[model samples]
Every structure is written in structure tokens, then in C-alpha cells.
Target: MSGKGDCYDNAVMESFFGTLKNEWVHHQQYQSRYQARSDIFKYIEGFYNTVRLHSSLGYMSPNEFEAKYHDNP
Candidate 1:
């Protein structure tokens, strides 16, 4: 846990949500709460974790990074 007034404690989450809003949320319209939930779930699990390349992970998708780590670890 982090102490008071430490933004670094949640920087990763802030970055992730910023990317999500910029890439997906702001561009879409939702007709229902269920539809929004489903779409966001798909975007995160199907595309973001599997296909999107992250600079912090050396331009590899999250799935690729996880696979490499398990293979070597």
C-alpha cells in the first residue's frame, strides 16, 4: 500500500483507464447498461489483452507478455 498523497500508487490504473476512454469509450454509444458492459468486456478481453501492443511491454500485447513470462519462468 502507498502512503497519503502518493499518485504513483495508482498511476498504472489511471493510465489504463485513460487509454480505454481514448481508444474505445468516447467513440461509442450505449443503448443499454448490459450492452455497454458486454462491449467493454469484449474490448478488454478480446482485443486489449490479446491484440493491442503496449509500449511498456516492449510493444507486445498482454497475452504475448504473459506467455513469454510463463515459458521462461
Candidate 2:
């Protein structure tokens, strides 16, 4: 289990949620909680992790960076 109650401990999680809400969640209207859940899952897993270009990863898609790292390592 992880330790609790430090600002830095949750920095990454907070940033991720902030981005999710700002970029995706706040833009959508769902008819039910299940629809919101499905959409958020798809947005994060299907699009954000696989296809979105992350600035921190040198503007490359996460999948591209991960493949390069494993190939070169």
C-alpha cells in the first residue's frame, strides 16, 4: 500500500484528473453514469494513452515512445 496525505504523493494523479476533466469530461454530456464511465475509459485508454501526443514524452504518442524505448534498450 502507498503512504497517504502528501501533496507530492498525489501530484501526478491530480494532474491527470485535471487534464481529463478539462479536456474531455467537461466537454461531454452523458445520459447516464454508465455512459460517462464508458466514454472516460475509452478516452483515456484508447485515445490518450495510445494515440495522443504527450508533450512530456517529447510530443510523441505514448505507444511510439514505449516501442522505441524497448527496441533501443
Candidate 3:
């Protein structure tokens, strides 16, 4: 939904990928596309979304942030 040639459109994703590369990708050497895909999945689901504390989310992991505000059944 970004306008043509907009500078800020990719900022969020650029930040995400930068974090992914810095925290997870740079240390590993994968042998195949499947291996890379699987490891990234584990990193995102197992650690980033569940355990990583994001400052933008008030130093809470995304799961914690969502649970804090949306605890209604």
C-alpha cells in the first residue's frame, strides 16, 4: 500500500530482515534452501515472536504484548 518511490514503505521489513540477518543468518552456513527455510521458521516462531523482547512493544515479546491486551476469551 505504499506510494511509488516512497522511502519509508520498506522501513519495517528492512528492520526485520536486518535483525534476522544479524541475529540468526550471519552465524550459520546452510547447505540447502529447505534447511534455510526451516531454520528461519524456527527462529521466528520459537524465539523472535515468543521470546525476543522488542522495545517497540514495551520490552515485551510479541506473544506477551498480545496476551497482555487481548486476554479475553
Candidate 4:
């Protein structure tokens, strides 16, 4: 956990949301709340975690990183 008023504590989450907005939310238009929710869920599960390459993770997607970690461990 991060201390009070510490940006570092929330840096990871902030980065995630920034990416989500930039790569997904900013490009889409939703007809209803349900549509927005469903689309965002799909984006996170189908693309962000599986396909998006993250620089901090050595240019690997989250799924790839986890798979490699478990395979080696």
C-alpha cells in the first residue's frame, strides 16, 4: 500500500487508466451505460491484458509476462 498523498503508490493504476483512455475510451462512442461497460470489459480482457505490449514488462503483454513467469517458476 502507498502512503497518504503519495503518487508513487498509485502510479501503476494511473498508468493503466491512462492507457485505457488513450487506446480505447477516447476512440469509442457508446449508446448506453450497459454498452460502455460491456465494451470496456472486453477491451480490458481481450486486448489490454492479452495483446497490448507493455514497455515495463519488457515489451510483453501482461498475459505473456505471467505465462513466462509461471513457466520458469
Q: Candidate 4 residues 2-71, lDDT tens each?
A: 7999989889898889989998899999999999999999999999878889898999998899999999
Question: What is the C-alpha lDDT profile of model 1 across 1-73, one tens digit per residue?
Answer: 9988788889989899999999999999999999999999999999998989999899999889999999999
Error of 3 at 59 (Å): 0.6
RMSD of each: 2.4, 2.6, 2.5, 2.4
**What's the true lDDT of residue 16 in model 3?**
94
Summarize candidate 3's per-residue lDDT along 3-50 as a digit string, tens digits: 977868899898999999999999999999999999999999999989
Stretches off by above 4 angstroms in model 2 are 1-6
| Candidate 1 ranges beyond 4 A from true positions | 1-6, 66-73
Which rank order by TM-score, best down to worst? Answer: 2, 3, 1, 4
How does candidate 1 fare on TM-score? 0.77
Candidate 2, residue 26: Cα displacement in angstroms equals 0.7
Q: What would the TM-scores of all predictions be?
A: 0.77, 0.82, 0.81, 0.76
- Model 2 Cα shift for residue 58 (angstroms): 1.5
Q: Indicate the worst ten consecutive residues by lDDT in candidate 3.
A: 64-73
- Candidate 3 Cα lDDT to native: 0.94
Specify the highest-TM-score model's number.
Answer: 2
lDDT value, residue 15 of candidate 4? 88
Give the TM-score (vs. native) of candidate 2. 0.82
Higher-ranked by TM-score: 2 or 4: 2
